[model samples]
Target: MTRSVETTSSEDSELSLPAPKERRRLREAAELTHDEIAAAVGVTAATVRSWESGRTAPRGRKRELYTQFLARLAARRQDGGPAGPPGEAKTARAAEEPAADPPVPDPPTGDTPTPDPPASDRPTPDTPASDRPTPDTPASDAPSPDARTEPEQLPAEPPARVPVPGPAEAFDALYALAARDLARQAYLLTGRGALALEAVEKAFVQAWDRWPEVATDPDPVGWVRAIAYEYALSPWHRFRRAHRQLDKPPAEPADRILLDALLALAPANRRTVLLYDGVGLDLPDTAAETEATTPTAGHRLVHAHADLADRIPELADVPLEKQSALLRDLFTALRPAVDLEPRPAAVVRGGGERRTRLWTRATLSLTAMIAVSTSYTLMTAPTHYEPPPAPGESVSGVPPLAGPQQLTERGKQLHDKLRADPEAGPARIAPRIE
Candidate 1:
């Protein structure tokens, strides 16, 4: 018996193929593991899990390859090929069954034996077993070579195994690894644990939302650190300064004095000292991060050191080489202790997009409103009027006829007349008064 197979176009396979369930079915039917499929598609097994779990879908070249792989498996099944070892049992059973009784009635047809019903019209005994279904069994009950396989029902309590980390897992790992250090850094910069925590949390949430991009970055932690630093410095947090001062934790007397002295310095000087002396960043790098010129950064650092020395006379005695080391140790001691744990992935990912969209809308609205207000003000503002020039006086462009000495003498005479008559006014004194 001949079987007809339907073929799918590459475009259809790539663009219109069913997702996780269909992919899962094809994989199970072919007795292939996720790793095997991943290797065939040139992706990680974790990526394959992501596809099967609906976390992500294959796209571009990967999608094309996955589609083609599934199509080949489907074709193999359609052509009576064994899906795997399980198929071999069915083949053996079909082979053991006796062939249908040969054409016995043909013998009565006389000498020529009626040239045995043309071979094309008769079913071939050699036809593969998969094409034939037993009458006692329903087609659905018996697994068909062409039918897609369904995932087997797993036990209520599945066995424990290590799970591969997908994008979400990787992001959580990164956050867990970096959050505490980032928070501590922010705390050192802002001098308030709560504000520092808030900044670090916000930056991490943003990182989580854009994990695919962040995961591929050369220094994802540094990117998040920069964001956290900027967040701590935002003007919106200034109102919290009084509260922070009230809630400041007590420190060793020396450390306390040092911190107070550091805080007293100008913000630029303080930041330069912290980034260069405390954090051990090079001058150029510190300057770039702080948005200052190298020369300006050097000036700030030098002034900061001088100011600190002036505040604590003991610092003046410390050698130049050891001063940076001392400051680094002092800053390290000042960093607030941070107890950090990985935040819920969903929560971290959810709020960032909403916040971004709201911020964008608000900014656009504010800009448009400001533009309109400015245009209206410029258009409606009253124009200044200048009185017509005195009849004998020249306009601004003409040079004065009188020499400087003559003008000076005339001015003196006018001043003397005004002094002699306390109430003398320009209108009364002028010869051309109407």
Candidate 2:
């Protein structure tokens, strides 16, 4: 079926998949190159080529835009709206060529162990102890009658008890719920199914590391939403690298239009509006979700409104004339973008075993190499081989020659010194002076 939403201004063609001829005509009418359209939708030029070739139809936002782009073209044509210059389209297309990939850092070297910084540099202060250690127990007043050597006993106090929710239970509940909500909001704002899922997953991983604090918060969902929004806008998310090849934009005109509109948005504005209006979060809550102040969030929402009014004029009037329609159009347009289907949770049942197997293999390989090299060296060397000495030099299992005599000499000297002193070692006892 034709995935694009129907509009009054233009007739939509059949939607089994956009025909190559229909897509080309739409592209020509919109004055967009395949690359330009692809860049707009954040896909690869190859993908765009595929769409035009009738090999595939753009899914998600690209699918949603099929009707919207044509309608916009029809509207512009009717109104004689000045088409943006040809050079602008050409320049944008040129900019879409894949750039050089960033250099990946090498994995950590085994030679260098990560050193722990000194305790003094640690964030929290250490609790200092009192001058004297507390005694375990005072001397007992009386001994037991059962035996003369019976030891004195001290009374025992009951163990102290604390009451609070279990940390892991609370943490799990907050993370699971907040993560799901954040993913939904991301899909709504970006309108890209994969992007929304990624944003949610990224936010949850980050939250996992700080669950202790986040779980205790009054609004964990808000916190997760904010994190997801930030992640959605990150440079990494902006450019998706699948396999070794760059993204190819969808070829269909509708897909091109939708992609272009989404790309036009500044990340912050898109995130703010989605988190606030789309997810029904208040301004303060939106700010919390986006990690911004209320004023900043308010400004983003305003800019988002302006951006919407400037681009996509069809949806604009509804929002302007009927506040409800504006909200409805936004939700409708964005719903496909952010829609996340039920997914199986990631399972790592045998991860430990796999890791252990890998380590074992690596160790065996390394050991084999070392043994081979050592054996080669020993075999090739000159033939006069001396076995290592036994632990002790003396026969009959007696210690080495320097052991017993030295201890006996030390003991004799100590005894002679003690006997030579009048008070054993000149005691420091108080004297009766009188």
Candidate 3:
């Protein structure tokens, strides 16, 4: 069962191979079929599989040969050769070459590298081979090149490969930071928690859909905020069932009053005030966001402040220019009556995609239907034209088509005379002699 090859030394008696899993991977990568490996290793295909699977290992001469074969495989792989055994010709040629008189021993693979000796002990152009300092010689006995390491002291660049955020990651970061706050603001506008959350989610969906524009925008958050505010303030929402009824008021009397005041304002005025006072935007910004002129935005803001101040005495004391601080503080103090949780980024992105798909399908279907209808009308229409009838004309003496009149007595008697004698009728009518 154990046969040792003549050339197999005690050191080569044992073999070291990769782990079972790694062996399988390497074997597959080498394009070595089970049969090819089995033939090369002088074993059956099943035996090769067993070896690779860690079910068994070769012993004696077989183990030695297997180790050599693995070394050849790795060497061949490193050399980038075609999938085949590493050539023995090179190994044999190396073995046949002459050896130097003083053989330098190969370094141990696991040992730490020895430090370089001083420059003086190192072999220079004039130094003899025997006189040159070896690793065993002390560094103090040699010399140092402190100059070489001094250049490393200057400041180096910041670490490279910083892993910049991708588009999706950046989008998610923006959403995570802004979604909750945006929803709260939306709730302030709509006075409905669910609608507020829906508005923010839909806004994010659109933002993701147009991410190229949104990402490149100088103020992505503001872009998203505008969309959310527009959706929350949309008049069409009033027709929906969810928005038809008033949402429950907040617990705090002050917040409830403020929310009521806000909701009562026309959408334009409310948005302008929210942007200017609550969101801390300037008049020009508020005007831009609300799609109104600066004067109009200011007008709305002054009126809104007046209205709110009328309802809330605290705001009434604050002047228009100073109202922003008070209003922003009041809005911040207002707690949402309900939990307004915005959807995940994934959900918003996927919903946007789905909505786009449905709209695209509808548009295509409509186009197809129109094309078919036009085609059908063209195919089935009458091609030939019948001549139109000539218009009627009025004659000079033609009487109107009235029913026949009753016969007179003279005509009746003549008719009786003709019936009595046919010849007398013609002779009386024809001659009429005196």
* Root-mean-square deviation per candidate: 23.7, 42.4, 29.7
> Can you tell me which runs of candidate 3 are displaced by over 4 Å?
1-145, 148-166, 316-322, 381-434
Ten-residue region with minimum lDDT total, candidate 3: 1-10
Clashing pairs in 1: none
Residue by residue across 72-161, what tens digits does model 1's lDDT show? 766656665555554332332243467795553432323654355455545568876666444577545855423434566777997789
Model 1 segments more than 4 A misplaced: 1-164, 240-246, 335-434
Q: How close to the true structure is residue 339 of candidate 3, measured as C-alpha lDDT?
A: 84
Output the number of the lDDT-best candidate: 3
TM-score to native of every candidate shown: 0.41, 0.37, 0.51
Structure candidate 3, residue pairs in collision: 118-143
Q: By the lDDT metric, which is better: model 1 or model 3?
A: 3
lDDT of 3 by residue, 144-178 (tens): 44444446566787877878888789889999989
**Ten-residue segment with the worst summed lDDT in candidate 2?**
342-351
Relative to the unseen true structure, what is the Cα RMSD of model 2? 42.4
Q: Write one digit per residue (lDDT tens) for candidate 2, span 1-434.
A: 11434332211223433467766655765567777776565545666776777754544344556545555545554454444444333232333466797685554465977455356533353444432223453325322223444566878878787767765556556655555656655654555667767677666555655767777665566666667777666676545554223234444444444445555778777777665545544455566566789799888878776776566644455544233234434454533422375242231113333555888999999999999999999999989878888685645866555654445888899879877867743372646467
lDDT of each: 0.68, 0.57, 0.74
Ranking by TM-score: 3, 1, 2
After superposition, candidate 2 runs with Cα above 4 Å error? 1-180, 189-192, 237-240, 243-260, 291-293, 319-325, 332-339, 342-434
Error (Å) of candidate 3 at residue 300 is 3.1
Candidate 2 CA-lDDT value: 0.57
